[model samples]
Target: MENLTFEQLPQAMRLLHEKLDRLEQRFEEQNTLQDAETIFNVTQAAAFLHLSVATLYVKTSRREVPFNKQGKRLYFYKAELDEWVRKGRKKTMSEIREEAGQHVLSTKRRT
Candidate 1:
């Protein structure tokens, strides 16, 4: 323990820092790849959407959900599922009426 001189300490610390940096870089790269992945199988998709497996299958049968098929296997993308959920949001009647009123105003202005 007492054999380590002052100059040796800095060199050892630098080596440790370089190794730590490489480890951190590898971790970040792995995390990025995981985050970028979007594919999910039927069970994963159902769990993500909080729907029953039967209901998910029904939607697939109706071609109402976004997915990819490889032979008999189906895959869903997390991003597409997110968008599908957003598209299913129902507009309030008041909001629809407001859009209709705007359409009428635009028509009058054109004429």
Candidate 2:
């Protein structure tokens, strides 16, 4: 390694820091792509979601679950399945109360 002059040390450190940041960003992107691209068959999907195979099939049949169909095959993306579960999340009591308060305030202002 070359001895860095005092004046050049900060510039060198800045450049190294930028390179490390770029490397970290690329690593994160690759990991996200890997997770988002994960595909599961019906059996795997059922296991992943902790549901019975029969129940998974029922949801797919009724189009209640997010899925992909190609010919006679069904496919599920791990990301999509995660999102589906998140979408079904229920509000907490605090959240409902806050919403009710907002509604009451708005209604009072209307009159």
Candidate 3:
């Protein structure tokens, strides 16, 4: 780092403050975007989920996917869609084994 004279310190500090303010503003913008819930129509939802529109429609009709309906339109929240996908996740073999062990322990006689 270059040495700064007392006279240059204030100017350097001002520049540093401006850069910090910009960084903070960017961080806040990113947080605002994350805090906003994304709502997607059927087509957009289908694209997000990598499903064909017809297949998405079928799933919605079957009440298999999380969604909201307003009159003739369907709306899906991105967070809810993410959770719905997560709900279908298969347990790893170790997880299944742990669950089975717990079940066995719970059912065992106390004697």
Query: How displaced is residue 21 in candidate 3, in Å?
Result: 14
Query: Worst ten-residue run, lDDT, model 2?
Result: 28-37
Candidate 1: C-alpha RMSD after superposition: 7.9
lDDT by residue for model 3 (1-110), tens: 99999999999999999999999999998876763488999999999999999999999999999999999999998879988898999999999999999888888955
- Where model 3 places Cα greater than 4 Å from the true spot, the runs are 1-36
Score each candidate by Cα lDDT: 0.91, 0.97, 0.92
Model 2's alpha-carbon lDDT is 0.97
Model 1 C-alpha lDDT per residue in residues 1-111, reported as the tens digit of each score: 458788799988898899999999999998766744769999999999999989999999999999899999999988788889999999999999999999999999999
Global CA lDDT computed for model 3: 0.92
Best to worst by lDDT, what's the order?
2, 3, 1
TM per candidate comes to 0.62, 0.78, 0.65
Highest-scoring model, lDDT:
2
Better of 1 and 2 by TM-score: 2
Query: Looking at model 1, which ten-residue stretch has the lowest summed lDDT?
Result: 29-38
Residue 24 shift from truth in candidate 2, angstroms: 2.3
Candidate 1, TM-score vs. the true structure?
A: 0.62
**Model 2, span 54-107: residue lDDT tens:** 999999999999999999999999999999999999999999999999999999
